[model samples]
Target: MEGISTLLSYILPGHSRSVTADYQFLQQSWLPTMHFQASLPRLPVPKLEDTCKKYLTTQKTILSPEEFQQTARNVDEFQLKEGPQLHQKLIEIDAENKHTSYISEPWFDMYLSDRRPLPINFNPYMIFYQEKNAAYNSPLVKATNIVISSARFLRALRAGLLEPQIFHMNKKKSDTKLFRVVTRILPSRIATYGAYLFKAFPLDMSQFENLFGTTRIPEIGKDRITKDPNARHVLVMRRGYFYTFDILNEDGSIRSPHEIASCINSILNDPREPNLCPIGILTTTERNQWAQNRRHLVDIGNADVFRKIDTATFLLILDDDLVSEDFPVLVRHFLHSDGCNRWFDKSFSLIITGKGWSGINFEHSWGDGVAVLRFCQDMKIDVSMRPHFHPEEQAHLPSSSPDVEKLDFKIDDVVMESVNRALKEYKHWTLERLTTKHLLHNIFNKKQCKNAGVSPDAIMQLSFQLALYKLEKRAVATYESCSTSAFKHGRTETVRSFTEQTKALCKAIVERGTSNVNNKEYKKMMIECSKTHAMLTKEAAMGQGFDRHLFMLKRIWQKYYDGEPPAIFKDPAFTKLNENILSTSTLNASVVMGGGFGPVVEHGYGIGYMIDDTDLSIRLAVASYKHNRDASEYIASLISAFEDIERILLSE
Candidate 1:
């Protein structure tokens, strides 16, 4: 060790240094000597650096600032000029294939849940299933390559579906990415057995109630209702954006809560008249109630019901009218089917929630079985981003219907009924839930999380803590017991770009997470915020946090739920969000924090996640008086389960 090479000193000095005399003894005692005699003291060391430089042409080629600038400019011009031309031909070819001359029909091939063994797995259980399947009859379902594409993109999407052979390959391939519709593939495989393609069922608006049945939301035991502080619900926006239902006076404050109530009432009176109005008047009783409760959460007594609607999450544009409420079947189809590559919960914000709307008690369906509750959330707004079911559109409902089995209600039926209700909520919740902040931290990171032994995630345990924490929070209700999303993969058609506007506030909150703020890093962040502000002010047509898609969402929400409408929940503005076009994960970390929620944790976007957190000794809590006890118990159950697993290891 004493004869080690000189490089070892710089690489691993492993010494302590002290600026004061307080620790001089320890520092001096441990440090190596400044001078040391070599084992071969008589030998002369070879000058390696000088010899290499002398043998080579010792010339240095360094680009200066001006040279760098000129080089960058030339490169930029080359790319800009050639990029479009290279892509134009492909774009033109695709556009030319459009069915402009053909007559179009609204008939859609609805995919019933399809089951297929895939190369993908979410939980350890799925991995176990894969091992078991390797021994089962997985003939064509084996590692056979298949090619499926959107009807519109038929040309560019062929050459793969050659033949189904005897191949057992679960090896995930990049080529297979385009075929995997994220939500559709995963949810259907887990929920239903295989893929099903059914024709659209036509519905006559006048006789709509007959095709699909309806039922009242049954009650549960009073003691079953939870009041846990950590109870929560999250609305991660998969797509589009959010907007406020009401606007404020020039002075900048809501007149009163009654204004909201009045607006809700007005919208119900006529929900269909699409004018440039706000988004409160067109909601149903359930939505109106939830809106009122939300107002209370945001400084309840200060403004009229409709006077000042919180428009913080307003302004969204959309690719299609898939955000409407009338297209339930289509919206949920791709949500749970592999028709789109998205995490189920991430694709649709109709996630499970322990936190009720703002303050009122309700359920969620996006992830939970709280169909009715999440439905109430969606009913409160106008979602033009989805397909709206008007009388004319209803005519396209399948002229013929499938025979849906009807089973009598039993005690066990309660769970199924809850499931159906949650499904209904999902139709609308998927879209509405996205634009709004999820019910995630409304309670999880609130004061109550401190008391319930809840806590934020540490660096390593971030995702585990986030999902598990949220799970426990919403597990208070039996219906909203459990549900989750999938992580993204580097599929052939992986999500490339995502908007950061949704999470700006959350980042601001994180910037304040630590106590010390007098650092250079903090100053740099301030400069960034200033830049964001400057960019926002330039785009006056769009407000701050104005993503075009999100802004469009805001406008639709304002018109449907905030202002007057032709019909509402009572009047019949109720509809579905994505019927078949499932959206997927689009949360910006910042939005997760600032939407008036709390301490940001993690969502397993691409990590192998497990909810294993110790040191829950830190009791975090949220305060919501009227809470669901069952949901609370479930949240407790999930948290305790993870804790127990960890505790068992500790005991061992």
Candidate 2:
């Protein structure tokens, strides 16, 4: 068996030999960078009393007095009796695991295994518009520039030339260094591999000659990725056809933009048959479903083609031309509703449309938006500095006509049926699940927030809550993501946006319209809300949020305690308030690259807002099922709420 395993390792791309070598190389290369990962404090088990107190306070507004009293009793009993013992056990567990975060393992497991539909549920997008010098209509020119820039940035990252992300303390004088948790590798057939190998950005200058393009191939239910380590080409998807073209010079340096443009022109102009079944649509299926289908596909010869596609540097999507500046058309390409223009499983894919407007759709599993934003900013700067070529420049460029390889799968009757099903399901899912709205508010910008004596974030958070109240006529459970990346492998903590002050302000604004609003009282209320918002946000950032702490405690009780479930855990009031109706986050990125995700629950809205000095942009997603709620109408209500609040503040 060992001998067979060894023989198979020699044949497979990321098999036993590669995994062993990769692990050894990873240990040596990452040892220097793991100091912070090692030195970071363990996720602290906060005093059960404090956590219970905070939990009770969060429930006060949502629960009736009698209901609150019952929850209070349950919390008191748990804290006084079993909580201390559980805390001790959790401390012991933390002490036992010294290398990684206690929450880190479970967090990742939950993220990957949740099996939600990707289009709007878990995946987020960032769209970059075509600037004066940045826009390139030709796929070859755009893809080459993006690939080269990405390679340089990634190499700099591995070489430690780029600055590590430091935690910016809100009030403290000094910035604290955080764990650099970004990984550029995307997962492929996670269940089959049980682990993924991180691809090292080409290090040696000459090594770059053998590398060119990488791609992800979608199977019936699951998807596999491949790359050609010895090939210097990139995968291009246009009008539902796939082709590969080289992007590197013989010596490994990237070819000139003009040369790449010529290669792309030849391929696009040359006639090629479209795919029999748009297999890329299967990437749109749920993870486990895809995995099951992938098992069946292995019997076919799709594995080798997939391996070649996944080995490329990255996937570059060349969309059909869009001459109009209509925001909807640009969004259709970026978000990619039904077209076969995207392979969504890649860690990151650069999408260049016909109008030269481009953006990125990235898998959230690899890294957060911060790292991707930095890369986007670098690309923007690089494009700005690049010299544009004239029409005559193409004639003078080097003529290296590399054979553009065409990679395709053999779609039998079984595979063809799956493909059709996927296309129909994905098309309907997009029409129902993904919706976009842009708000450019002249009055509710950063300056307006300051003049109104409130933090911009707090104002926006309150506005979302207020809009929900107006629309639903009740306070809804809301979530605001607070980054805890200050700690090792830290991701996020949930900050409850529904506060006492928010509740009061919403009621007041509803009763007294903008005409009869009280400026002094409203200003005073908003100021208090701002302070409360800041305090909760600070606690969340400090790893003292209510959700994770309670989650761990419940898990501990289930593991160690032999008694029945705690009343607090089974209480209806607690369960009701815990249902997240509005999953919101303030992800501040360049306006062009800012994007959002779908709400976690079916009847909820995912709100990603960016508040600039002069304007505010919101990316909203909601399930368009049965007209439960309309995202556009909600945005209008939010706009009206902002207007009412501003009017009340300035009336005095």
Best by lDDT: 2
* Per-candidate clashes, comma-separated: 142, 17
For each candidate, what is the lDDT? Answer: 0.21, 0.61
Root-mean-square deviation (CA) per prediction: 33.1, 10.1
Estimate, for each residue in 1-652, the C-alpha lDDT of model 1 and write its tens digit: 2232233234332332211121111111111211111110111111223222211111111123464354445334433543233234323432453421000110000000111111011100000011122321121111110000010011111111111111112324311323233212433213111111111111101111111111111111100111211111111111212212322222222222233223222222222322222121112113333333334433523233222111111111111223222222222222221112122211112221111111111111111112222222222221111112222322233322221111111223333343344335433433332111111211123132223232222111222222333443210000001111011100011110111221232243233432333223333433343344333332211111212122122233443344432121111101211110111221111101111111111111112111112212222221111121222333353354334223212221
For model 2, the superposed segments whose C-alpha errors exceed 4 Å read 1-43, 134-140, 167-235, 244-267, 321-324, 386-403, 432-434, 515-517, 555-564, 591-594, 614-626
lDDT of 2 by residue, 1-652 (tens): 2443354335334433213222111112221222223334445556677788888888886777898899889889888777777778877887787655566665655555566656666666666645454335344555555655654444334333343343332413222121122221212112111111222111112111112233334434333334455455566676666667666445333454565666666555655455657777777787777666655676787787666456655667766445555765555446555746566766677777665666777665545565566667766555444533333455564444465676777667887788788888887767765566655566656776777777888888888988878887778778898867655556668898788888898888787755544767788888999999989998987788878877777777877778787777888876776677788876565536445666667677777777753234434333322245577888888888878777765756
TM-scores for every predicted model: 0.19, 0.80
Residue 280 of candidate 1: its Cα lDDT?
18
Candidate 2, position 65, lDDT: 85
